[model samples]
Target: MSVDNRRVDASPSPAAPPPPDPGAAYAPGPARPPGPASRLRRFATPVGILAGVVGAFGYVATFDPNEPGHYPVCPLLGLTGVYCPGCGGLRSAYAFAHGDIGTAFGANAVAVVGYFLFAAVWVLWMVRAGRGKPLRIGLAPVYWWGIGALLLIFSVVRNLPFGSALAP
Candidate 1:
């Protein structure tokens, strides 16, 4: 032959796969049905979180935040004499735990609203976990910004004389 110009392909064909072993006795099947233990396992995280929250509320309820030298003062309030959104959060929690709803709102209306929001979210999380679905709180950036603006407004209002009722 004068010249050989043909190119040879090196790659394996896509349709080809390694042959299965005939000697194997067992093959993987579909997933097994969830048992009582499995269902309980799914709820472990939500229950643990609830336990932690309950413990924290219990501690706050036991040790009054309104009393002097009980809890740490908010650094922003201590330094600038200006209230932050979370300034009275502990006190609010204490009041809420004690079933003093009005006092809780008086301490921090935003914090009281936040407590209820957290409870709602926690319930949703628990329900989704029970259903084997992931909890999705996909808030838009605008919503987050709006929340921040609201907190800023709350902080500013609580500091003003007219909004003194919002202060702790």
Candidate 2:
């Protein structure tokens, strides 16, 4: 066969690379992320929130809210005999502490809902902590408004004779 000089390649071999330099490597080393403890510090916000919740629950449990002088009086109650949104929270907590389900529900249906809410939030916090995700309260304004409206309705319904069973 006759030689074809035009087909000769000018580029280096595809399989071979340039020799490594005697100096520092140009390739970056893997970036090691922070460990759990360090990551926890970075996530101080969620930690603070969780601690506050635990402390609040502990305080409520240790000092029964039903007992007078443990907590400040509800301003709304002093102004009117009517049941405010938070009127029966203390009694409901006390009932919950003593395992009196009927009393708990009677003290405040809304508070019973609060108890479940607290439990769900606590569970989520624990789960997110395990996964190294921050506990974020991303509720929409509309959802918060819905909660407020629900409480207002709860307050009104509990005060009425029809919803007397809801009263403490």
Candidate 3:
């Protein structure tokens, strides 16, 4: 018997179907075409958010929360005889809007931090929106729990005699 040494699998295979064109995905496939409004639509949400924020801050800046009958008392504080995390949020906002950082912090240090945090996140959201990218706040469960715990601690601490400094 003669032994054959030739390789059986060296034959050229069909050129892989031209790689699904990378640009094909972007090609307007004769379907609904993009228009000027589509570009503007991307900005609508972010701009609306900013406008609402500005409007709210404007109201807070104009109307004093410290004034009687302007804002309602916090229900939790009213009923529970304890300071809730948001007990003085409006006062903090009012103080912050008027550039009284010290009073804002005195009212609610956590709320002051929240104000700065919101500002930072809003700036980031605007930048992403302007770039046509989605602004996602995908915090993990752990982060959420940490925030809850921090608030809980703040609530408890403020109600204690030692934490009067944190009271609204």
Candidate 4:
């Protein structure tokens, strides 16, 4: 009996694709133009957000947060006498709704800034939706940290004597 010395290949066929590159960025394929219904659907989220904000502002405007029993006091302020970042935000909103921008800022400067920031972002979102593009706010970690630091500073300052101007 003669012994055969030929080896058989068990590896994948040469036609098979190579593994994808993990570091490669994803590129979307060509997109079709949005129709009327598609445009309406895209705009829905921003519109809904606007409606909710308007409703909330309307309610705050109607009920004065400065008056007792109108709105609940901030638990942190009520308990420990420390003003959180959100303290007096309701009064700020209420003043803003009534077109009292100066009073609104006096109530909570941070909240006023946030309100304007939200409005700007909402406008951008609407514009992107109209153009059939997704609104992507890809803020870096540094930006998030900066925002946290700002809120912390605001909260700390508002509670101090020097920051009495910032307090409600």
Candidate 5:
């Protein structure tokens, strides 16, 4: 018998079956495995952050900022004969750690404040991480600008002869 090419085979056949339902065909994909990279990141990030905090405080505990050469000299101060705002931070931290608040303030009031700020922020970060939440601070544009201006002023002041006390 000759087959009719023009006529369509509309009827469902006994042997050949219809395609499965789209909904039924899709089984929920198996829960994705926690990949190696993600696992590494999860463990590494928090520990690194914590280690940094501890290392900072540890340096403050062990070293006296008043003494020279424990920390590296500020290249900016030496090279340009100008004091950067950060010149005496390590010494300030050492003073603050040793309960010589007056000396810390004399060394660098701003760095002392920064050390406390870092401690507080790190505590907040640890608390949030413990609760399975990430800690993030997004300052407003005005605040950022203000911070920049403050740093600039500090740099300028520390370099001036009258601001010698603020210098290292």
Candidate 6:
């Protein structure tokens, strides 16, 4: 006897478990606007960060780094007679805090740039905090490596005769 080629059971599949109640699972939706207390709590971290930075700048502004006894010398400069990228950072900060932009740049242009960068980042962080949104600084590995390379190049150039301007 010839066997039937077609299958006998042609029933439709069961309905998919009512497409799992989206509400049941924790699906991220628009974040609830923070209340006054919650918003204040969020500001606490950014404010603390600002306070710490201001305190540091205040200390640097008060204590003169140009005085030999106040700040320690860069170990690299002391040992290898090489000017590190951060060799004049304290002096730069001192001049920057005192509103002497030219001297700050002369002390260390990169450090002056760093101060501005910090200010920009801090402002952005404060803005995000005020808006109840988390500030995210997600830099790629390449960017970090590039920064390292730039510092290295700056150090090397400052030590060279032609790059005397970069020296502290």
lDDT of each: 0.90, 0.78, 0.86, 0.92, 0.77, 0.90
What candidate 6 gets wrong by more than 4 Å, as runs, is 1-37
lDDT of 6: 0.90
Off by over 4 Å in 2: 1-72
Q: Model 5, range 25-65, lDDT digits (tens) per residue?
A: 67576988754444445446667987886788777779775
Clashes of each: 0, 0, 0, 0, 0, 0
Cα TM-score per model: 0.77, 0.64, 0.75, 0.78, 0.65, 0.77
Best by TM-score: 4
Ranking by lDDT: 4, 6, 1, 3, 2, 5
lDDT of 2 at 88: 79
Worst 10 residues of 5 by lDDT: 34-43
Error of 4 at 68 (Å): 0.8
Model 2 C-alpha RMSD to native: 8.7
Writing each residue's lDDT as its tens digit, candidate 4 over 1-168 gives 988889888986779666778999776878789555587799999999999999999999999998899778888998999999998899999999999999999999999999999999999999999998889999999999999999999999999999999998
Q: Candidates ranked by TM-score, best first?
A: 4, 1, 6, 3, 5, 2
Candidate 4 Cα misplacement greater than 4 A, ranges: 1-37
Query: What local lDDT does model 1 show for residue 36?
Result: 50
> How well is each residue in 70-90 modelled by candidate 1, as lDDT tens digits?
988889888988899998899
The deviation in Å at residue 134 for candidate 6 is 0.5
Query: Top lDDT: which candidate number?
Result: 4
Cα shift from native, residue 21, model 4 (Å):
34
For candidate 1, what is the TM-score?
0.77
Where does the lowest 10-residue lDDT sum fall in candidate 4?
A: 28-37
